[model samples]
Target chain A: MQGVEQGVLDLDEDVNRYLDDSEVTVPETYEEPVTLRHLGTHTAGFESAIDPDVVADWDAIVPLETVLVDQMPPRVRPPGELVGYSNYGAALAGHIVAEAHDTTFEEYVQSEIFEPLNMTHSTFAQPVPDDSPGNIAAGHTRDGDGFQTVDTVYINMRPAGSMTATARDLAAFMRVHLGAGTVDNRRVLQTDTVRVMHDQHHVRHPAVTNWRYGFHEYGHPDAGVLGHSGATVHFSSHLVLVPASDVGIFVNYNSNSSEHPPPGTVIDEILAVCGLQSSSTEPTPTAQPGSRERAETVAGGYSLSSLPQSGPLQVIDVLEHVSVEPAAQNRLRTVTLAGNTRQWVETDPYVYHEVDGNDVLAFEVRDGEVERMYMASEPTGVYQPVPAHERQLVTGSILGVSLAGFGLSLAGWGRQCARQTWKQYRTETDSVTEGEHTE
Target chain B: MTDHSESIHSQQSGHPAEHIESDERTRSLTWLARVAGVTLSTVSLGFVLLLLVVIESGGELTLITRPFLMQVVLTLPYLIGFLTVGTTAGAVLAWWHRYWSRRVRIHHTLLAVLGLGFSWQLVRLGFITL
Candidate 1:
């Protein structure tokens, strides 16, 4: 918002112009240019670039530039082609914002967003500030025995999800969006610019609502809601704004678990209690007979579009499987790497809708085969089916060879042990006989 | 004549005794090498297998997420090194056994090779992490 207001950035301008060679080198495999608008709308065509270690240790916070360069997930499809949620792209935007301001991203957000809104309790610092206004909540994960407290994760892409804020501080920040970029007559963002930010930037699928600048659109326009949810290894947070009522709610959780109601659900429950229509009125489309064929063409294993296609880490392709399996009633079930299965109904020829949610998955078919798929979950556009070499077949071969090798080795060891014992016995018997002869 | 004959026979027996003792010492050292070589190779192979299983299991190694290749790049070196070292050790042990030991054992060499091979599958099964 600051960059747009200062005229340092043009939403339609190609983001590559602002990024220097040292900062970021977004590979351009296609003619389409990735603009600031694409990044904001989560249609940058980049896949999910996740490092499990990002927040594994808060002490090991890495430089943003390093993460940008090292974790640059491949752009598998052209920009503006699909809406795939990308933390990397969001962080890249933050980088661009910092570069425009001539300061660190953390420092810039602190001085700009935090200071302007008087969010004294909020800090973007990795490992978070020790002297913040409120007590930092500990995050947790459950194991076989019980829930275990997990340390706060600090990703190099801090701008994406590293901000630590108290409920009180968030309330102040929420007021700005609720108040149309101002609170108590203090302008954090110009009214016009906030209008543009709040406007529909991209529609993920026909059935679901569109994506605004930095927020996800939910529910009908009559009872619409704009919000964003974030989760680290330990903590989860959601900030929802109901523009009609001029009401905003901010919620935060100390622990992370599958058992916990997702922040979206909490927002819905809150809206219900407030007598608002929290349920989405998605227009379900008529089923196309060829929808099954189109879905089948795209139904296969898809590696992350954001991962390295070449080099050693390309092996991570296996860990990033997003299988699009066809289910009953022309619906598609997408089983993600984390083992979370989401049911998607075909709302259009090649578009899928999350059963009762706003999530969308759209596929691009060419020459009777699936060429690309853009998911609404995060900015990830998966292009090209996972090659045979990178699939489970290769893994099976490696396992088979390794097994054969181990079996042979173990058998050899057993035989050697028996031989050694037999030789020892023979040597002792020979020695005894020799002693008797000498006597 | 009897004294002379006994002396000659004693010297002949003494020469064979010296040769046998020398062979026994060489065989003892070779046996020790065989033991060290097989044991070290086996242990190395075990670790290599763990690394493989970890990669295959996507860091889980259980009935959870499908064991697709996890961070397999981090594991290749250990697997390759295990195989190379085990094979080299086997070759050296076989050569040593043939040249020095009175009783040649093929099991020592096979043990090394098989140990490394077993480790690869262990990795696929996800019992370990690299």
Candidate 2:
């Protein structure tokens, strides 16, 4: 905490420290440079390796610095390479905070962040206080017999998972981010710094797609959504915010039933109730059960021999080359030869099942037999399909860049009138750039 | 002869009525006991299953061991509730079936309670070992 307060442990400094000591040994001096930002954002490439003995009491155990130092190794990746989810990185950051403040990690967080935010109900401890108000929902699992308690897990990883807080308290934490780093007039982080944290820092591996800083970046940069999800042995929780819409959501569940709604359900439902349209209007097909007419209509076999053998095929292949077997009323077992996966196709007529971003296929019966297909031109990639509007925007951006380059060359003639004319043309052509500058 | 014959008939009729009432009470108690037992067993089982799912569904598995498990056992009251309700129902049923058999009722009640308590404790401990 002191290092961060003293501005001695900046993001780049921490990254450099990790990179320098990544292969061999970490110097003692490098330890003080780690901070909460590095851990929370996973900028520090700390290894996940942990000692078995210490992990035994993971939930309640508070390991001394010596134990942690002896057990875990330095970061695996180079500093600032990309955000790869690292719990050990967060642990090291916690250690740095503890050392800097001359107090425990729990104490520093309690005094610095928790108390200031008025998150009185939150605690970084095991065995929540008996007198704590609000219901501590009992965690349960659904087995063949029924729901049972799970009694395993250590408390030693408290910095990473020992947090216990009410929904309201979590909401308050969200409010801090939503309010631009200030909660109840107390600034936990600078507004610009919080914005930086929310910005896309690194793209996680396997595919250079999802941006990872401390966690997965939610929603597009323009869409203004940010959050993280935390799952424990018997519970799952999420905290999210849509800053542009001035909205925030928090959800926690103790049951392991897939029947329970997904994490974003509450937020989506709330947005729907408010009659707000999502920034992204891409249609998503949801699977439902027990609808007769639609199921019978879409139930049939489909084939697509027109598709190219390899590389990227046209959207037509995705739409036409599919088969559906009626499972129940309203539900049809969809078979796509391309992906080779069985998907539950919904029966909603207006809402077409999305085979890909632009392509929406409907399984309908034309005559006596069930075989009808619909296709649309669309782009395909591992990442979410770029919207048509976004594609147009990209094109416009490229055009604007070309135009700006031309104007810059024209202005190099060193004529005052020519420069003014070029500036006006540039401003007119790229209003977006000018608007961003004004903001 | 008339007095002896009348007394014999009355004894035969009363014996069947007593048997029917005892049978009805035993059936009622047994049904109650079964409901309680299944409810408790299902809940405990569910708790364990939920933990597994949480761990499998991207939860940190290392968090569910030892001191943490012990803390959950102590703080969470659901396990205790399940055992108490299940055992009490079993005890009441045993009493109903063996109304005259005090020893049998006590033995069954104790056994049911002990079995449930032991199972709960064992599951709690097993999570750590596993």
Candidate 3:
């Protein structure tokens, strides 16, 4: 965005135009070039593995260009089609920013965005550089009995995840976005640029959650709640900007334990105490006519489009299939392999609201068949129908049956080997006695 | 005695332990066949069982979401390919060799066949590429 404000990069221009080498490997069939806007909106259609294969050891980390060219994930879908949250796309956009300024991405951001915003504690440098102020928090994992401290791994694609900052600094950053790129009378961005960014860039559906330039619509669609959530294996952070209320919140946690409350929980309480969020009393509307019939139309297994559509990680899609089952009284139940069950009630045609929650389940129906399903809270990606063969029941059954066959065969082989050994021993003993008598 | 000892050593070295347990088992299978069979039964099964343990313990849904476990899962195909090829050859040898009892022969053949079928399941599940 800083690059866009300075005219160093154009939002609509193809990202490949900024690359001196290592262009994004779009499929031969896909003619549409992935633009900077697509990267920002996460509509670049990259079917990447959840991991970009970041290096574990800091020393093993390579240059961004090397990872981009050598380990570039294949583009399996057409650009501007699906909203698949992509770290690679974010990293690519950062690379373009660096290229435009003839400097490293870290240096460019340091000079342009971070320093100007006075985010002194944040740095893209790996290991946070020895001299940087403030100690980095150690992340933790939930062990059997308690939490165990874990090392923070290096993110090779620095632009994607490598940043060390406190909630205070992030709140300062958020204030700028909320204050129209001005915080404390220091203008960090042009008013128009800020307005353009806050506006919806790409929308999955007007009725469902949509993506702004970088933030996803959260809470209520019109509550003006836009937030971006970031997580690694151990640590998770969430930043929300309620532009309408001129309120913003930033929460960072060092642990992602099930016992630990989600960042949203903290944010919600803060919002509630401040008299901002009053969603608890929002009365549930009466079920619209034809709700059950509409629910039946969208019932089936769905795979998140953000998940890998090809490669070994594709099995993750198989294991994590989300099934939508029609329930009693025009309610729909969404069940996940993770064993989460969310019930939604239809309040509008093809649009369902959580029975007692804030999330919305809106489906796009075409020709009486569901084409896409959108969850308001999961603004990063949308779900598409899973094919019959890829469904969990089918794959899980095959795996179970196969294991049984191998196990039974193995047991039989063991029995046969044991029986043969005993018989051979007896035969040898009898032959030895007969030979002794002859001698 | 020296010549006799040399002859014995020569025989031992020249032929594999022959019984189904040793080279004499050459009548049934070679050492390669044993290793492949053991790996197909134990190694592959061990991995799947470990996966099941992880899943039953609530790792199934979270496995895909976590990057570390996924890195381990994606590396299985390269390692499992050896078993796939070996089991294929082992199945062929079990069918061709006629020395063992009918049941034993069928046991080896059945294991090989089942192992191949398990590999197919892995492929269908997208763990192994077709």
**Real A-B contacts recovered, model 1:** 0.10
Candidate lDDT scores, in order, read 0.67, 0.51, 0.76
Candidate that beats the other on TM-score, 1 or 2, i.e. the better one: 1
- Give model 2's docking category: incorrect
Query: lDDT tens digits, residues A231-256, model 2?
Result: 65566676666777778878777764
How many residue pairs clash in each candidate at the backbone level? 18, 37, 10
Candidate 1 docking band: incorrect
Candidate 3 clash pair list: B16-B23, B17-B22, B17-B23, B17-B24, B18-B22, B18-B23, B18-B24, B18-B25, B19-B24, B19-B25
lDDT of 1 by residue, A119-163 (tens): 888888877666766777777665566776654556677687678
Candidate 3 ranges beyond 4 A from true positions: A21-29, A257-261, A272-275, A278-289, A310-312, A433-439, B1-38, B49-82, B85-117, B124-126
**Candidate maximizing lDDT:** 3
Q: Which of the predicted structures, 1 or 2, would earn the higher DockQ when compared with the native?
A: 1
Off by over 4 Å in 2: A1-8, A15-38, A43-60, A64-67, A70-75, A129-135, A143-146, A204-215, A220-222, A257-261, A265-439, B1-130
Report the poorest 10 consecutive residues by lDDT, candidate 3 chain B.
Answer: B15-24
Instruction: Tell me how many residue pairs clash in candidate 3.
Output: 10
Order candidates by TM-score, high to low. Answer: 3, 1, 2
Model 2 chain A lDDT-worst window of ten:
A376-385
Error of 1 at A270 (Å): 4.3
Q: In order, what is each prediction's RMSD in angstroms?
A: 9.1, 31.3, 7.0
